[model samples]
Target: MDEFAFVDRSKTNAEKYVLRQKLFGTEEVMPLWVADMDIATPECVLEAITKRLAHPIVGYEIMSDSAYEAQIEWFATHHDFVMKREWLSYSPSVVASIGCAIRAFSDAEDEVIVMDPVYPPFYSQVRENNRTLVIHTLNQDEEGIYRFDLDRLSTQTSEKTKVLLLCSPHNPVGRVWSYEELSALCRWCEERGIVIISDEIHCDLVYAPHKHISTARIIPENTVMLLGPGKTFNMAGFSISTVCIPSQLLRDKFEIERKRVHWGDGAVLSHIGFEAAYREGRGWYYKLIAHLSQNAEYIDKTLSSTPIQYAKPEATYLAWLDCRALGMDDRELRKFFVKEARLGLSPGLSFGKEGSGFMRLNFAVTSQTLTEALEKLRGALQGDAYV
Candidate 1:
């Protein structure tokens, strides 16, 4: 009955645990990598999935319109963006939609703009699809806030540039773009005839006083918004998400690619669970925000005097730690965390060149787990005396 309870995923064959040896070269470190939460999935989602199993047939079924409606309603209520049923379609995952959209919107060799230090898949999808990549680096201001320079972005594109992959409430660096920022980016992309693909999976996990504005809301006709309850309710195991394409022309193109892949209406249980997550999981979702906000603040305070520097993220559960003060190359940084700190965190260099001298820590764990991890980090730092 504890709303902030977390489950032990170590024995569950979860990727985060299973890949420790392969990723960090040791099973000794506590994994705080990967984006999914160690917090329990919402009870309402579990109950709905369990109820669906009472029927023995367990057959393939189309995702109910009501399930999509639940999402539409959630979006309107939370983000202040209303969606038409016609604009939405089922996707197995947001990354899958990004791949399909890449193929749907642009041809091989055309440029797709991706901001550096974004989710790694954003880079891979473009390369895998044979599209050229335009890397736009986001710089942090003196206040340690990550921001995109419009003037610099303007200098990076050309006629061959066809799409912009935007991570609103961006991953790794964790910035929730302001309304003025989103509006200006949309306007810039629109005038340049670029299709904006906004990935808003973390839309609902944002902290207080910081609002997540849907990019599609700014210029509906020019955006392809990828959304889902996977991150919000910790149900990524369901492999369910929705892609919203407001432009009929883009929808037709995306449909052609979607059909080619045949990522059919997802599973029946996922449909039940997705609906319950949005419609009935509000209480659990709010409690998670409080927990994550506390963790973010905790990291900010904990690392204030340490060699590592951390800026409390405006959104998402990720903590982007500045390790430049430690004065190690990326390889040493990775080694230090694995061998010295006994923590498996995401090395920032893997995100992009701009992520150098940084590491990402996932704070969506029980308070006790977070406390232990931070203590281990502090101990490691004190022992190394790297500063």
Candidate 2:
């Protein structure tokens, strides 16, 4: 808790930095926009970094066997999944890896399919690579739950659809996909010979009663699963990410491009953090999840009583709030909260066209922070704009 306390405080500090920089020199709102947690690094991670710092020699380092083992063992023990060292390829971050994969395997004009309202970076990667962006928006029921439309995806996939960027336990929506959904998705891509790049960064931080189904575990040969401790351990600034490609041929192809673009180095601390987090920090992770789960429940209850309604998240600290009851556009709604409520949140449209009228809130802060933000949100809803 002590370690993560600093992280939590840093969010407020970031908000202060932005708020203090106005032309009028007036301070503004608290920021809960970024997906990063307010919690500090776990004690085990801090001890590792501290020990590394004491060495006084932060030099270029090779990826360690223990680092790989740490991730391998964590998967086997926690998710009933096993990974081979041969499949492990290092990347500085997932976004870089996504770009590398597209450049390595697909042509300039090939299509990269991603679910709409996905992590916005996915959209950026596809477009930036000069590839066609094929978005198949998820279907939502009347109750506001998102459902996978396999038929829609199948109709979209073709020979030119060479890649599908899959977000397991999806962001913004916080759905821990079922085994059936994953299997069906893999089969869909497999039939079309589309490569599957599964981003499972949030797999480790899942809330209880919802199991994270790793796509590669079910269909290892065809999928490349991306996993890292950065998001799980609140170490995103460290920028350590891993790509598990079961096929050696595919791994070699990715490596050729990853090295050419220099996406495979300079995250020494993230590697150390990853090793320590997986090897020696199980207890801390358990406690962290317990606290985050409590926070999710509190938001669920708070939103239920207010005009805004949130589907209780099955995984991830992000809450997908349905603010459609207020009948406000995404931009106006976002500004209303930022100004009136004094709370900063991620606007839904930033995720995708499908995210309009919704907002994504980070609930990984302290309970006090969560309470204060919710109160402000309530006040914002009662403003004349909403009235």
Tell me the spans in candidate 2 whose CA falls farther than 4 Å from its real position.
Answer: 1-27, 384-387
In order, the Cα lDDT scores of the candidates are 0.92, 0.81
Give TM per candidate.
0.98, 0.93
Candidate 1 backbone collisions, by pair: none
Q: What C-alpha lDDT, on a 0 to 100 scale, does residue 337 get in candidate 2?
A: 72
Worst 10 residues of 2 by lDDT: 16-25
lDDT of 2 by residue, 1-387 (tens): 322353435345444235433521234666677777877778899899888888777788888988999999999998998888888877778888888888877999999998988899999999999999999898787876788798877777678989988888799888888898888888887888888888898998787778998888888878878888877888787878899999887888888887788764556777788899999989888988988888888887877878887878888889888788888887678767766777667788888998998888888888878887887777776663322
lDDT of 1 by residue, 1-387 (tens): 234766878889899999999999988989999899998898898899888898898899999889999999999999999999999999999999999999998999999999999999999999999999999999888888888988999998999999999998899888999999999999999999999999999999898789999998999989999999888898889999999998999899999999999999999999999999999999888889988999999888888889898888889999999999999999999999999889999999989999999999999888888888998899888895322
Q: How many clashes would you count in candidate 1?
A: 0
Supply candidate 2's per-residue lDDT for 274: 82
RMSD to true structure for each model, in Å: 1.9, 2.9
